[model samples]
Target: MTTNKLEQLKQMTVVVADTGDIDAIREFAPVDATTNPSLLFKAAQLPRYQSVVRGVVDWSKTQGGDINTQLINCSDRLAVDIGAEILKIIPGTISTEVDARASFDTQATLKKAYRLIELYEQSGISSDRILIKIASTWEGIRAAELLEREGIRCNLTLLFSLQQAMACADAGIYLISPFVGRILDWYKADTGRDHYPAAEDPGVVSVKEIFNYYKAHAYDTIVMGASFRNCEEIEQLAGCDRLTISPQLLEQLKQDNAPLIRKLDPARAEAATAKISLQENLFRWSLNENPMATEKLAEGIRNFAADQRKLETLLQQFWR
Candidate 1:
């Protein structure tokens, strides 16, 4: 079966790989790809990436920081290096994340993003090779705004509420990864249930809310629905601007013989009424007001940061 869904949805959306697995990415053939610290952490443990880890180790040694400190820095460095390598295989960009610890520090997030861009540039990749990943926090949006003004683009991740998205578009950032899977997870965790059907899923409603709001307002910010738990969700969002699926789901999609439906349309969006924007304070307050987003955002950051540390440990072992 051909993953030719992209052709059908050509006018409506872009397809993106949401995996660090190069083989599956090659199989599905998404033009662009995205990776978080968690995915990179898992990929770096494979023997094929052992040499990659060693390369980081050797590079880390030359840098003159303490061994563990050097290793941690090298893990971040390696994520960008590996992402850039994947760019050579795909036709479009690779996303490399900023440290999640910097999620609340606008200046620190900006600096880390710049450092990643510089790494890509030094490796012969241009600004277009990468999208700096940042949490969709108030500080993160502020950092993305700064990056946008400086010609550095960003992918706002860990997003849930409509508030985070409107602010990103207002700031003219490149993309927003409104997580579909995680949104479902939040509802499941709270209500102890699943929202699998498009019409029934409040999670689907959340992303649709974001997508329509962006399109109707003429915002150029790309909405890439991410972290999908199942192909049902993916099928429902087939005509979104982009959908970033894991390699496992991509394979499942290829195996399943079901026909895909186009769920969203700009023409349809054009007919819907628009929504108003919220200022920074209002957006922050609204996000904080949502119990699910507030708890999940903090939890997501901590989990991703822990994976970053584990990735660093793997690199140190590779060096030895």
Candidate 2:
């Protein structure tokens, strides 16, 4: 019996479902699941999740705050509620993202992270099983450093460059989600190219570089490749620490029975890259220098913030 690509890929990498859809999560049965504002927004609009949305809104009514505050509270609660639902089906952890609007505010990010964990704890979910997802801004990374010291794991997201990865690792973050598809998007638009082979894909190259650097330096931070554009990108990153693939790509992998080759291996990875002593100024400057990383990082934050606001608007309807 020949194993499908999804099974073969999972043999080497921890496959994570990158969606807020519970049905898709049940179908893919990934070890872990991740949700962002965009995914949560999509899930919130689905008829199946109406009860979850209403429940959060109804619960928010009893919390006693103004409409705006209540909307924020409801959005956060809904994220955790969906995550809690996903947690029931998966044996591993779930990545619930912090509000992207707080990406630059260390204190705000920390507070929101604390509140999210508090909500999860209130739901009888341990902090150990939750990874507070935050953007890879310097402030966010600092916030994560403090949270990690207090036993709160973090997933530094929207990462597009090695500098971001190094900063997260230096902070002892639990994981970093380097956006592969977004990187490819940046390059295609910049260079005006339509397609690139999987092996030579800039996004694939970026993740491989980060993965190799982490493995070579023996950094404990896990590099999870995310935001894949196609199955080829996923196939190329066969042995990453983790890969959070969307359900569409997951289905494609499940249908394809082709041989899945492992392209990344820590044992065979050898890079002479020295450890980066990244301070705030240098980290910011490096990001400023890399146009693709800079643009994509800011764009990612804006997009997530927009979706968060959209989700808030959707929840407002239930407030009445």
Candidate 3:
């Protein structure tokens, strides 16, 4: 009997469900799950999560502040509540993101992260099961460094280039989510090409480089490939530490019985290489020089922040 690609992939890589749908989470039974503002915005509109939304709004109202303040509080609670629900299903950690608007503000990001963890604890969820997701901005990286010291693990997201990954490793971050699909999007738009072969795909290639570098250097930070365009991208990264995939692709993988091979191996990875230290100036300059990374990082933050506002607006309807 042949095993489905999904099962095979799970045997190697830690497959993470990248959605806010509880039903999908139950169906796929991923070991881990991740959610961002966009996913939470969509999940908030779902009927099953309506009660969760209402409960959070009700709680926020009792806290007492202006409507804006209440909305902010409610949104944070909703994200945590959804994450808590996800945690109940998965044995692994859930990556709940911080406000993208705070991406460039280290102090504000730290404050928000602390509050998020507190909310989780209030809900009886431990900090160990929560991965605070922050953007890969220099400020965000700085914020994560502080959080890690307090035993708060972070998922450094919106990453594109090696510089961001190196900076995260240097900061002792828990995990880094390299947006595989977005990198491919940039190259397609920039070169006016339709598609690239899976092995040669720019996104796949980028993750491979990051994976190899981290493994070769024996960095403790994990490399989780995120934001995939298709199963091919996931297949190309068969042995990644983790891959947070959307439900649609998860279903596709479940149906296909094709053999899956491990594409990345730490044991077979080349020997350790000389580590490069990335200070603020070099990190900023290198990111500035890489047009794709710079553009995608900014675009990702803007899109996430926009969805966050949208989520708040949706929650506002329950303010009555």
The local distance difference test score of each candidate is 0.82, 0.95, 0.95
For 1-320, candidate 3 gives per-residue lDDT tens digits of 89999999999999999999999999999998999999999999999999999999999999999999999999999999999999988999999999999999999999999999999999999999999999999999999999999999999999999889999999999999999999999999999999899998999999988999999998999999999999999999999999999999999999999999899998776633467989999999999899999999999999999999999999999877
TM-score of each: 0.94, 0.99, 0.98
- The pairs that clash in candidate 2 are none
Over 4 Å off, model 2: none
Clashes in model 1: which pairs?
none
Which segments of candidate 1 are over 4 A away from where they belong?
1-12, 194-196, 270-274
Query: Among all windows of ten consecutive residues in candidate 2, which has the lowest summed lDDT?
Result: 268-277
Candidate 2 to truth, TM: 0.99
Clashing pairs in 3: none
